[model samples]
Target: MRTIRRALDLGCDFFDTAESYGPFVNEELLGRALRGRRDDAVVATKFGWEYEGTARGALNSRPEHIREAVDGSLSRLGTDRIDLLHQHRVDLEVPIEDVAGAVGELIAAGKVLHFGLSEAGASTVRRAHEVCPVSVLQTEYSLWERHLEQEILPVIRDLGIGLVPYSPLGRGFLIHRWVEDS
Candidate 1:
């Protein structure tokens, strides 16, 4: 917490968290860390699943659920507006347009600045973008996870959307020392 606070104090303007992380604990942590300094930072968080009875998970992307999720996220983050809001995963049951439409409403209401999608296939990405401009696409992409380059990357690039690669270092497995030692 002190490290996060110090980073925020030193002109760090961006922070990322997820609803799934600790089942919302991360958002709360960031909220506490940014208490009075909320305006100084841009907070980005993901939404998709909710913990089930303290052990399992389930997908929920219904329009109403999305609204509720945003409200919950707002409360947890202690922020009036989220700098960037991302759908953590694709809900196969719900149409991507509907998901994007829900986020679009939040953007329209000034609750979220930008909309993003994570781990969505190319078709879903196209459909969602049609509903609202996707400012960014977050995915696992590295030398090892090169699947995105074949399809998702081209679609996002063609649409002029930014790509935010998670696990860019292959989740710590790509460290030079690890490769060298191996």
Candidate 2:
């Protein structure tokens, strides 16, 4: 809680969370932490997994499930709308078009402000965007991880979609490396 408050105090307004994280606890915490400061923050969260009493199951991005997930997230976050909602992962069983369409409906209903995709490939990104524009793409991008530079990066750049690197610090590797070199 103190960490969150301190981040907010320092102007860290963009926050990202996923239903898969703690399966729900994290969103609840953010909701409580942002009690009165909701307007000051841009909350981004994701859905795409099925859960059975907290035990996360396989990918389930069914259109109906997306609706249920958003409702649950909204309640847990204590926010009327999600600033940027993403599909945590690509579900092969479900077509990307369906996923994007579902999110588009949510956007139209004002439940979600923007649509995003996480860990999706270039082709998937293109197809999804064709159905509904993707505002952002989230992936592991850092000095240590640049695999996307060749293909994925170009595709997103051409589409005019923004990138939200999940681990710009290489998941603590860069920090450790810096300290070791020092």
Worst 10-residue lDDT window, candidate 2:
1-10
Candidate 2 differs from the real structure by a C-alpha RMSD in angstroms, to one decimal, of 1.3
Which runs of model 1 end up more than 4 angstroms from their true locations?
53-56, 176-182
1-182 per-residue lDDT for model 1 (tens digits): 79888897787878989878877888999999999989888899988876664443788888898888899899999989999999999999899999999999999999999999999889999999999999899999887789988888899989999988999887788797688998
lDDT of 1 at 103: 93
Strongest candidate by lDDT: 2
TM-score of each: 0.92, 0.95
lDDT of 2 at 27: 98
Q: What are the lDDT figures for the candidates, one per model?
A: 0.89, 0.95
- Evaluate residue 47 in candidate 2 and report its C-alpha lDDT on the 0 to 100 scale: 97
RMSD of each: 2.0, 1.3
Clashing pairs in 1: none
| Tens digit per residue, CA lDDT, model 2, 1-182 | 77888899999999999898898999999999999999989999999999999999999999999999999999999999999999999999999999999999999999999999999999999999999999999999988899899999999999999999978999999888899999
